[model samples]
Target: MRHYQPGSVVQMVRDAIVGRCRHIAPRTFLMVAAAVTGLVTGVTAYLLKKMIVFVSKSVIGIIHPDGFSLWFVLLALCGIILSAVFQRYVVRDYVEDGCSRIIMRDLRERKYYLKKRDMIAAFMASSITLGFGGSAGAEGPIAFTGGAIGSNLGRFAGARKSDVRLLIGIGAGAGIAGIFQAPLGGMLFTLEIMAMPMTTWAVMALALGCVTSAMTSASLAGFRIDFPVGSFSDFSLGLLPAVLLLGLFCGLYSVYYNTTGNIAAGLIARVRTWWGRAVVSGLMLGVCVSMVPMLYGEGYSAMGRLMSGDYGVLGVNSVFSDMATPPSLILLAGAVLVLKGIAKASATRGGGVGGDFAPTLFAGCVAGFFFAQVSDALFGVRLPPVEMAFVGMAGVMAGAVRAPLMAAFLVAEMSGTYRIFFPIIIVAAVSYATARIAERVIRNVKSCAERAR
Candidate 1:
């Protein structure tokens, strides 16, 4: 047994190392793998966001410093056309519901693998879609990209099939964390929206990934929060009823937004060719932008202004330079709040590569501000619009996505304080409950109709 060559000891050590690695618990290995995934996903998300900003500023800004001009509209059309051509000729397939696709793949195949080419294609398409004023969000593409990265990494590391799904969740959460710089929000989104199993091990892994990713992005990006609404010292128990009413309103509006978006998507789906859909959607979007101008891009700039009490600043940097009276501003805001969802839905279904994530937030902002304006006009309530705007943001997100915890945490994190935590929670809970009830009612009605048929 003791007869060994000079290389025998080296080979024995190599075997021992391999054996040790094999002996590691699957959960332990998955946790470690998740950390690596989070790191990579965070870095990738950071770079992707910067790329979008650079493209939007350098390309779109140079061409149309005043937003939603004819030049901007033409460029948006061209970008959509180019994206359609790329999808047809090069990618050959476009991912519509990025998160849903990832979840479906794992459910059907028991394994997940994101092709390198698909990741690149999604990234490029999303960049072009948003950079050229497509009314969409970056969250969907970024989440998909993160899942792809995690899936591939897990496969490379010899993780089990089940473990790969968890890794995908971890990466997705990390992506959200990176984008919003909100670790808790990311974890909750993964748990609630992605329907990630809530085992202790899974939670730990997701938390680890989200924290790592958020920290990574924050460190690199200097920890900038998206919308920083100032302090809210006007806490009034008298406003509780109004807050509840606002929540109900937001829930109803969410239903309307979802219905409108579905209808728009169905209509757009009638187009057989990608370029045809692009042209139709592009023309529709151009018409919308030509009128509102603030409907351009993700509407974040408009949202920020609303939160900062800058009502007269609508289309400030855009082509519609005419400042409006307070009454007209209210009407314009109402129009934007009503039509923005349809526009966003059209963009997504009409061959534009973007996500519904940002649209929901935009709708929430509009709903909140609209509620404030109405309250001030009707009841002469001295309610703070900014505070209501923040609440509305949480309300719409919760109702639309059915993720109250995530929505609340996201709003809190974005606002850089938890002073309004109670209001945020109230709005989120009410909106979520209302949305669920409404969905149930719709389902019952549909079922009754089917039975009658």
Candidate 2:
């Protein structure tokens, strides 16, 4: 037998694979690539989640929930500063707002290719940010990472730009589906949030990718992401009024969140130095988290507790724990709903890397609970808090993200039932309409003022 160099053997194997690929039909190749992208994206999502969890447990897990500690301020500060430094020095690129960046690139540049570094940059930066207790979500960075994976894979295969775009969507959809274990939600996100034009082939590819990713994620994590739910209360016309009011409440809250989030981000952006921004972000987060400990991290744990009827989780680590009475808890929940947007913006803009997805849902959950309490106290309307919270999650998310169907479907998947599907749709629709109307009013008012000047 002829001895071959190790390098020669690798090259021969690569040549064989490439030679075989050349014979495969383009559509078949694309479909195979989509499946591979989904599988890889699922792994990426799992790793990102594990990194965040490990970091969080190492840092914040030491703190006692029965009492208060300002150490979280330091942890939050360090996390943001580290993420900013990593982005500026290590990555040497802007990797935040992955979704927006992807959309802008596709629309403006017609370039479906992303740098290879992107596959890991957002993952590392966001891991550090969330691990250190930054109030942001992992979904955005994973989506960005996934898109890069798909884009690069297509480009490597010498695919056309249109084909590359489809790959990008597959990667993104797979990422969302993997993280949330909601395949339909993931596909909808690409179509609705990414604004990808849907074709039959595109839909099929997305479905394959999303389902694969979600299955991978579920297998790796050993469980699906879920929220505790109350017994399915009978839906009656009598409950319609409360459902409508909840939708309106969610929409108005979404507007407030968007407006304040912008203002907060703008304020932080004024800081010239990375350290200055970090300090400002740290101080802002420190104050908010100090007041409401649930403001720390993505607040998913708190959301779980809220859904499970454990209201004490809201005030447990808070300095305001002394006032954990029902009335005080209601007030605290309202405060969380108000401050979450600011906290999220501060973390993301202040050199930390994360997405708004979790923060939006967390705020929605709190908003629903707060509304339920206030309604019960004032009007004696005995709405199920758990069910209302579930609906509110979809409503505010729908309004804030401007993707009603995705939001509704995501909630359906999380709840593991379609019993509440119709209510979610009703709330999502009203919330979307209300947000649109409010946003238009705000815009026209601003324009009028500008014209007057």
Candidate 3:
């Protein structure tokens, strides 16, 4: 290895690259930069996912696979404590509420510099939380990490504000693409979820970034769709009524989801010390997880089990295992659905780190499954629980995150087909509308109560 003069060779190389960049069209340069960002974000997503999996497998290895073990609660509590300590001491930064932070910065159109630690802090914290069964998703943390990567890249290149903002969107979109391997879904996420205005060039850049990230992740991880609805003849005009009802149910469920999360966070925030918050959250989460083992982690495996018609897995390693009847299983699903939001809130607010995407999707699956079972048992109407589960995912996510297009496209891509696209679109629309109305009513009621006081 040869040593160069300080600020000599490095500065010369930087100047050379900057000079070359000046000759290129702005759009062309942006596209190139977006692709590079996508590549980097993809690798980061892959690494973060592997970290979670490694920790998750290790934790699961020690647990009794066939029966309930009290160790689940203890191990999960340890994870929350460890994550809180790491964030407070090692990271020494504010890394929570990553998606909200990004949106606020974008809405304000402020020139904020995301620190280098921001790129890795959420990634590490979320992995520890989820790996130890902290009942949350990875999507939000990865998006935050990706946005930081894009922001820092723009800062390094001295890009304009508009360009930096666009890059941030691209990175976030690519991050989702990398994690889910859904290019179209990723583009929709950036456009709808991020509330970014899209021009022809911007759309092109976002698409390129998302596609490249998806390709990279696929190449590295060997592409596989987690929940695949192989063949279903259950979607018809007769089922349309059920679909509509499910949509309404999901809408109301989304209201509960948002409300529960907010309430839990608010309650946890009252704790004066970080350890106190962790202990409080840990007790709540442990009780939920102990009673319903399916509530642990992102609950993807539980969702898959439901989709495949193995409802018994919902009660695995939990107190509900003995109640294996269909009606009882439906009730168990309902319990998991409600408890999931609380568990997710506990994980993130209790010094752990995670996202809402997984929890909402998990709840949607449960809601759909529960509705199908109850409808058949009560009214003697048979609806496909599997298809309903899939559509419910889109509906709940659309309402919870208020991104119908993103939710619809994400489900479509996840299933690798457009067979259920029409139902997904309808359900997502209904759910979003219902959620909006419910939120307004709740807001008015609170206002009235305050005025009376």
On lDDT, the stronger of 2 and 3 is: 2
Residue 233 local lDDT, model 2: 69
Question: How displaced is residue 422 in candidate 1, in Å?
Answer: 0.7
Q: Please, what is the TM-score per model?
A: 0.90, 0.95, 0.95
Off by over 4 Å in 1: 1-23, 65-68, 99-102, 317-321, 442-453
* Count of clashing pairs, candidate 3: 0
- Whole-structure CA lDDT of model 2: 0.84
Worst 10 residues of 1 by lDDT: 95-104
Who is ahead in TM-score, 1 or 3? 3
| Candidate 3 local lDDT, 1-453, one digit each (tens) | 445587687666766677777788888889988998899998888888889999999988887456676777787798889888888999896565545455447547664567788888898899888999988888888888888888888767667778888888888888888887788978988887777887999999999999998889877887877676577664578778888888898999999998998898889899998899998887778778887889888887778888988878878887678788878988888888878878888888878888777788888888888888899889998888888888999999988989888888887887778887889999999999999999999999999999999
Write out the backbone clash pairs for model 2.
Answer: none
Better of 1 and 2 by lDDT: 2
